[model samples]
Target: MSNSPKKENLVSIIMPAYNCEKFIKDAINSVIKQTYQSWELIVIDDGSRDNSVGIVKELLNNDDRIRLYINEKNQGVSATRNRAISLAAGDWIAFLDSDDMWERTKLEKQVTFAKKNNAEFLFTGSSYINEDGNYYQGIFDVPKKVTYKKLRTHNVISCSSVLIKKRFFGSIKMEKDDMHEDYAVWLRILRTGVCAYGVNEPLLIYRISRTSKSGNKIKTIKMTYKVFRFIGINPFGSAYFMLKHIMGSLKKYRRIKFIN
Candidate 1:
């Protein structure tokens, strides 16, 4: 990976960590291996009780672009991500969860695609992986462009595959205490007339674990209903969207499981 800096278009990567020591190394190394050279990785440790901080520190020694921040006490992912977002000094902000990894050309291709289409918010397709790092089926099949109306009923954006312009950070900060906080933020951005574009190619390895927050199916459905309510949709409208979300989720999971 070339460390040479480019003069323009620096993308800042935001990573929020909890007790993710097992997969943190691959995540950080994925950033280091990116073909795009002009970027900074800001990793916020949310009071991890493991060696997650130590692993990050070791990687920081050689590269000045990767910086680590710490929270004295445990904070939620939204709070940790907001801290990193505040410190981002780039025109574009990309996200990579601590347990997820990216392809080497992920950033390189995204930068070109976003610029080409003049998109403010963008997300790419992602492949799924199990706890053992075993590959699963390609679960994400993103469309060329997603509108606010399209996203109201379903959220197709993945946190790790997002590359958003920094201008929206001022108005749309992530909501704390929300199970689908990332989905809420995307809806908020789209409401402001920003169209979310998708690259339609798998650029991220999204890890699925039984212990993860998203692993609980029942809770996810509950939280998704809450998301629609939080966004101020009426009860009838919320029901319609919630049903759509549930059906889509079931269909997607069934396809993935059958393939495995």
Candidate 2:
């Protein structure tokens, strides 16, 4: 862990997991490696019927700052996140995925930005890392101010890179629907009249592989369609966005498009 100031603030890092055995440790390590020492790592096992839970328990046993919560059955990501929020006692709420990792100075940099800007909510930029450590990143425009209209088209915030005030959770929680739960939750918080700020620098590593949830083309298209629909945007909007996305994917896959 690098040197972050010994601030008395405690940030709750909530994660919802299903079956992320291969990447869970790297995610946990990313949190532990944070230069900021004032964070509690909360791992919610959404009734994972795999070694995911077992491995999380083992890690919790070794680290006092980590807490592992297991559900009796699979409720879903929305429920798991709500429960984690309910159990958290920190002043700030940060989220991370079981399959993602962060840089050692991520929290340090973001917290400093928040304090100086007096930002109640923050969303940072991120880069994609494959299972074997290959990377690709998006360079997004970090607006001086963010609004619902600005975010509807381009979601500058990644779920795993958001850090918000804990009080926001009490007023706004995750939507249980399968379509864009994270996006919906962000909207809910915004409705309460708080603005979200963007950190231009990329600090988190979002991992993807053949086994990842986002690897499925059909499901990705479905979720994208639903996101536009739920936001009260015209259904035809999805057609334009989906086209752009497919073209982007084509460029991303390049020579191996057929195999990918």
Tens digits of lDDT, candidate 1, 45-140: 998989999999999987889999999888898888888999988888999999999999999999999788877788998888888888876467
Per residue, candidate 2 scores C-alpha lDDT tens digits across 42-160 of 99898776799888888878778888988898888888899999998788889999998998988888889988989989987766777876675443335656776556655557789
Give the range where candidate 2 is weakest over 10 consecutive residues by summed lDDT: 251-260
Q: Which residues of candidate 2, in runs, are more than 4 Å off?
A: 1-8, 137-144, 231-260
For each of the candidates, the C-alpha root-mean-square deviation to the true structure, in angstroms, is 1.8, 4.1
TM-score per model over all chains: 0.95, 0.83
Compute the lDDT of residue 98 as modeled in candidate 2.
Answer: 92
Cα displacement (Å) at residue 25, model 1: 0.5
User: How much is 259 displaced in model 2, in angstroms?
Assistant: 17
Q: Model 2: what TM-score?
A: 0.83
Instruction: Assess each prediction's global lDDT (C-alpha) against the native.
Output: 0.87, 0.77
**Relative to the unseen true structure, what is the C-alpha lDDT of residue 69 in candidate 2, on a scale of 0 to 100?**
86
Top lDDT model: 1
